[model samples]
Target: MHAIRIEEHGGPEVMRWTELPDPVPGPGEALVRLGAAGVNYLDVGARAQGTGGWAAPAVLGAEGMGHVTALGPGVHGLAVGDRVAWFYHPGSYAELLAVPADSLVKVPDGVPDELAGGVLMQGLTANHLGTETYPVGPGDTAVVHAAAGGVGLLLTQLVKARGGNVIGLVSRPEKTDAARAAGADHVLVHSGAGFEEAVRELTGGRGADVVYDGGGADTFTSSQLALRPHGVHAYYGPFMGVPTLRPTDLPNSILLTYPVVHHHVATREALVRRSGEVFDLLLDGRLTLRVTGRYRLAEAARAHADLESRRTTGKLMLLP
Candidate 1:
């Protein structure tokens, strides 16, 4: 078997594709033959600085889909040759993985391999933002930062599906079409702050019901200012920069929360249910997944570099 192993955290150049002894399923685990693995900024963080609790001297990646080749002792509800996907499991950069069966969900029919392989991590994050952090309803307004990016694109569709309006934010003009294509009601091309006024104007001065912030400190204030009084501000990813705030620093009586996807799907039943909702939306044609890049598993270093450059949009998948 071959996997991307990083001896020390540094940069994309540190990732190396190397052969290793094949993994075997352990107790309560399933041995999966790798079909596709999702490439995420999380992997880059793990490689570059050992962020996200993934220490060095380890294989990279946490999300993917594959076929079950074998099951370990005491495992049930799964069989050999079943197609499965997991939202969180370390060492997913390899060609085969012995993942806990409880962490696995059966991929439903009509879900493409690419979507099934990569959707859960970012998809569940979007799901948590739209459902738990703030349940978007009809006539509600949401300001989503990085609306053309992976989580933003999906969150746009989710807000639309829930009958809410989306004001999408993009860093570049070239990204406007992508954000609009994902069902954003309006797209704004800007940097840092200064877009709150536009958001207020779009909402007729009442301001947005919520702001889904994926970027870090630079846009933090603007995201908060764009929301109405008592509106929710859900911040998820902070790979860019972490912001600081005092309780008195908060404006508009707005609520600020840093939502983690694990809390949204804390149990196996919740995982099955939440993932089913995402898959059903995809099957019903209401939610569309954009896979903008695909790479060979051995070429993972190049994928990391591309993601780090922040040029690629939507999802990137690695096929073994």
Candidate 2:
């Protein structure tokens, strides 16, 4: 099997592709012959700083879509030849991955491997954010930073589908257009002065009912400022960098929530039930899986470079 391994963390240049022994599934696990692997901001963060939780020489990737090539002992619900998509903490960026049986979800008919790969992590993040964290309603308004990025695009659509209005903040004009196409009611370019004030004006002075701030350090303060009193502010990622804040930094009246999807959807039942709803939306054509870029497995370094430099939009996938 071929895999990209990080012996040390620093930059995309550190990623090395090499032939490796195939991974064998353990009890309650399955070996997936990966078709496509999703590239996420977390992978970039891991490559740059190392996953603070893991050691060196780690395989980095969170989600992928593939087929069950082998099922280990005690893995019953899934079988060899079944099309599946899975989320793994550290080993999806390979030709073969040993994923816990519990993490595997059967891919629906007609959903391509690329699309499935694109959505698993980002789609599940959007589902938990929209349905669990803030639970946006018809008249509610949300301000989503990086609205043209993978999770942002999906989150915007899910919020709109629930009848909420979305105020999308993007770093570029083209991304602004993409955000609007994804169902944001208004798109605001973040470079302009008074960007936070613009969000207040868009919400008719009360501010957004919820603010999804994945931009981390750069937009953290503005995100809190853009939320209404008592409104929730959810911070998930640190695409800019991990946020450092003082106790007084947040608005006194607002509720701050840092909900990690990994913890929120910990159980197999929870993960599947939540992901099933997302898949239903995708299948019904209500949700669009926007795959903005694709690269071969050996080009994993280039993929990371594009994501880190913000040179790509929506979801990026690595085909194996």
Candidate 3:
């Protein structure tokens, strides 16, 4: 089998396509012949920083969709030939992956492989963020940073479905249309800062009820300024480096949260329930997955470069 491996921490160029011995499933695992693998910031950042819970010479991917070709001893509830998608699994950038059976989620019949693979991690994160973390609902005004990015796009759609008004924040004008298409009621490009004033102006001085900030330091202060009294700020990612907060930095009665999808869907039951909900929404056409870029598995470096460049919208996947 062949996989994209990171032999040393560096830039996107550090990712190498290499041949490897085929892997066999261990007990309670299944060997899946991958159709597509989701390329995410986590994968790219991990490859660059050497800090994604693995070391050098590691196969670096966290999610994929595929068909089960073999099962190891003690595996149950999933069998050979099952079409499945999983998150938090390593080595998904390969032609075949050995994933724990319990980690697998059945992909619905109509969901394409790329879509399934594309949404597993980001969609699940959006699910918890939209429905559970801050609970965006009727009459609420929500602000999402990086609104045209993978998780942001899904989060925008889900927020709209829940009856919340969405304000999407992006770094460039090219991303605004995609964010609007994803259901953002307002899309703001961060030109010369002071985006908080725009949010206030759009909301008629009321500010947003919730801010889903994935951009970290670059947007944290402005996101803080853009919140209403008692509003919640859910900081989920560090795309611009981590930000710091002080007690005096926020409004009175404000709530600050940082929800990670893995922690939210930590168990089989949680994973199944959340993923099922996302699939239900996707199948019903209430939610959509957009794969703006596709790369051959051998072009993993270019995929990472495109992602880091912030020029691509929605999801990027690798077909093996």
Best model per lDDT: 1
Cα RMSD (angstroms) for every candidate in the order listed: 0.8, 1.5, 1.2
Higher-lDDT candidate among 1 and 3? 1
lDDT tens digits by residue: candidate 3, 78-138? 8778899997797789998889899999998999888888897999999989888888879
Candidate 1 Cα misplacement greater than 4 A, ranges: none
User: Over the stretch 1-320, how does candidate 2's per-residue lDDT look in tens digits?
Assistant: 88998999888998999789988899999998988999988788778876546467788888888999998899988878999997655778889988888888999897877888879789988988998899989989998888999999999999999999999988888787789999989998884225778888877788889988888767777888888888898988655666777777778488888878887578988888877888899988889989888899999999998888875679889998
Reference-based lDDT, residue 66, model 2: 92
TM-score of candidate 3 on Cα atoms, chains taken together: 0.97
Alpha-carbon error at 164 in model 3, in Å? Answer: 0.8
Q: Give the C-alpha miss distance for residue 242 in model 1, angstroms.
A: 1.1
Worst 10 residues of 2 by lDDT: 188-197
Error of 3 at 46 (Å): 0.3
**Tens-digit per-residue lDDT, 1-320, candidate 1:** 99999999898889999899999899999999989999988888888888888788999999999999999999999999999999889999999999999999999988988899999988999999999999999999999999988899999999999999999999889889999999999999986789999999999999999999887888899999898999998987677778888989889999999999999999989999999999998899988889998999999999999887778788889998
How do the candidates rank by lDDT, highest first?
1, 3, 2
